[model samples]
Target: MTLPEKPASGAEQPTMAELAEGYASKAGLHRSSNGNIDVLKSAGGVQGIAESVLPGLVFLVAFTITRDLPVALIGSLATAAAFTIARLIQRRPLTQALAGVVGVGLSAWLANSTGKAEDFYVLGFFTNVAYILAMALSIAFRWPFAGLIFGFIRNEGLEWRKHPARMKAYKIGTWVIISVLVLRLVVQVPLYFMGEAGLAALATTRLLMGAPLYILGVWVAWLLTRPAPAPADPGTERS
Candidate 1:
């Protein structure tokens, strides 16, 4: 009796070996040093960092000097607007600048309308809470946000979830990110309740923890998901 032949590579469903090879290659591409740099670049690099922090810094300084809410709010909003305008003029991406403007505007409105300086940080605090909730849900569903992001970056769809090892790696990475967000809330929430001095503390906390902590989390996620180095080829092995 003639035995049945196995399907050709292109005609067959991907074997475990093929899946692993593809997954490893994609993960290596995304978890490289350059990929880490891309994370910072997406956050608007040096200029983006400045755009994010400067307006808040200006507000804090103005508030400290004048102790006048309206004056401080105006200073902050003006700085945000100027950054946005500059980005527009330079033909750079407006995402960071525009986000800064909206954030500062909402913050200013809240602080001014309520006559409570601490209210300025309310939006940010709640935004963190929302992120925590979303991340928690993703983890519970076994469709981690980190995995989704990795898949999106690789343009490889959701195939990573099919591999038990990769799925676990993504789950761990997502938890790491969730931990960072939770830590922010744990530290910042108490300060938000303290009124004026608390607002100052909150602002300082935000400046200190914001981008640095985020970058650290990204690095940690990359480390967790990075593929193991491939085994050396027998032909290329050193004697």
Candidate 2:
């Protein structure tokens, strides 16, 4: 069966297999002499970002309108529905939305039972994390020997042998953690300098801001994780 392809200019889109093989060929050009590093970039930048972010925007707008946590959550669910409807209307893929609903629901249920409400953000966070990990997991499953680890979402079938200290993955993950922490600070920093009105505005702004970050994370995920390309040779990396 044909996998989906990016739309072309005034021409029919290529099949998913075509796109996959095309990416494979493009990736083949950038191999390290030692055959360890696998570079990745996503082709579905604009479209994927839009699809991913739509739900977040809906949730944020709903939060603004509702102004109550539980009601805002219901609004978030409605936002998800709206996102699904819009995707159907546009004929975009529904896999992301469907998966988001399931993943978000599960995460919410689990967090409520075992973790604090602080553990839960909008569904965007869970959706993006799940989607991105799906890509990495795909790579890990496909090829365990490219000397690489945690292939970013594209899962370009890199050969990952363990590094001396697993330093690279640690570095990337560390930066991601730091960046998230800094962003949380950016959100909270204003509280110190704000009046009642300022605090209200700050809260509103954060409530609204989540949509874009979550969507951007989702978009990044699509890029970071794509389907693994088939191995061309016995020695070639598959993950």
Candidate 3:
């Protein structure tokens, strides 16, 4: 009997560049047909904004009304779970919703362990510091995180590293992002120290400075580091 033909190999895995591009795309970075970065989409649109804000908002409202840490934690976690379940029912990607659930769960655990409502927000301070340090290191290493992100979004690949001007622009962009994280710590840390009395203010500022502020920072960075327009060909000029 003739030997059976070997099966074809599965599709090749994506290259690092392609993987980076995919990540940037999921991060909501996209250039419109008109060549403008879609800031609203990058901010994950309205549904995404609600996903990022609602859990904390629920916790704040619950605590404000009842002044009970356990009730507030339950409310927050429930809000996150509702979003996750809705995503599952709709057969949509679960990444953002699941992250929200995990975050809420962790915050709940911390606050429950400490018996302090403010401990719920303690995780967020560490998160901000981690991001700030990471971005700062990327800039110091001459591989600004902004370059890795925006470069892929703009399809510049790693070529931006060859040009000093491009490098300077990306470093600036990275600093802009770092600045946003720093501002969060600067404004929120004080409120966190006020303990339960500061919980309301802490939660309120966290909501205000969370996704909304980050979007603004990214928008500014995009504009600042945008590639310069190509020079017009002299031959194409009107006679």
In model 3, what is the error at residue 27, expressed in angstroms? 3.8
Which structure is stronger by TM-score: 2 or 3? Answer: 3
Q: CA lDDT, every prediction?
A: 0.79, 0.44, 0.88
Full ranking by lDDT: 3, 1, 2
Candidate 1 residue lDDT tens string, 50-159: 88788889999899899999999999999999998998899986877888899999999999999988888889888888988998899899999888766555444688
How do the residues 1-239 of candidate 3 rate in per-residue lDDT, one tens digit apiece?
Answer: 99996756675667665765586877667555564577777776777789999999999999889988899999999999999998899898898899889988999999999999889999999999999999999999999988988887777888999999999999999999899999999999999998888878899999999988998998888889998899998888965
Q: Taking the tens digit of each residue's C-alpha lDDT, what string does model 2 give over 128-214?
A: 455455545544454321112233212422422244233343334433433443464466446524533353454455454543443
Winner by lDDT? 3
Compared with the true structure, the alpha-carbon lDDT of candidate 2 equals 0.44
Error of 3 at 47 (Å): 1.6
Q: What are the clash counts of all predictions, listed in order? A: 0, 19, 0
- After superposition, the stretches of candidate 1 with alpha carbons farther than 4 Å from their true spots are 1-39, 152-157, 234-239
TM-score of 1: 0.81
RMSD of each: 6.8, 12.7, 5.1
- lDDT: which is higher, 1 or 2? 1
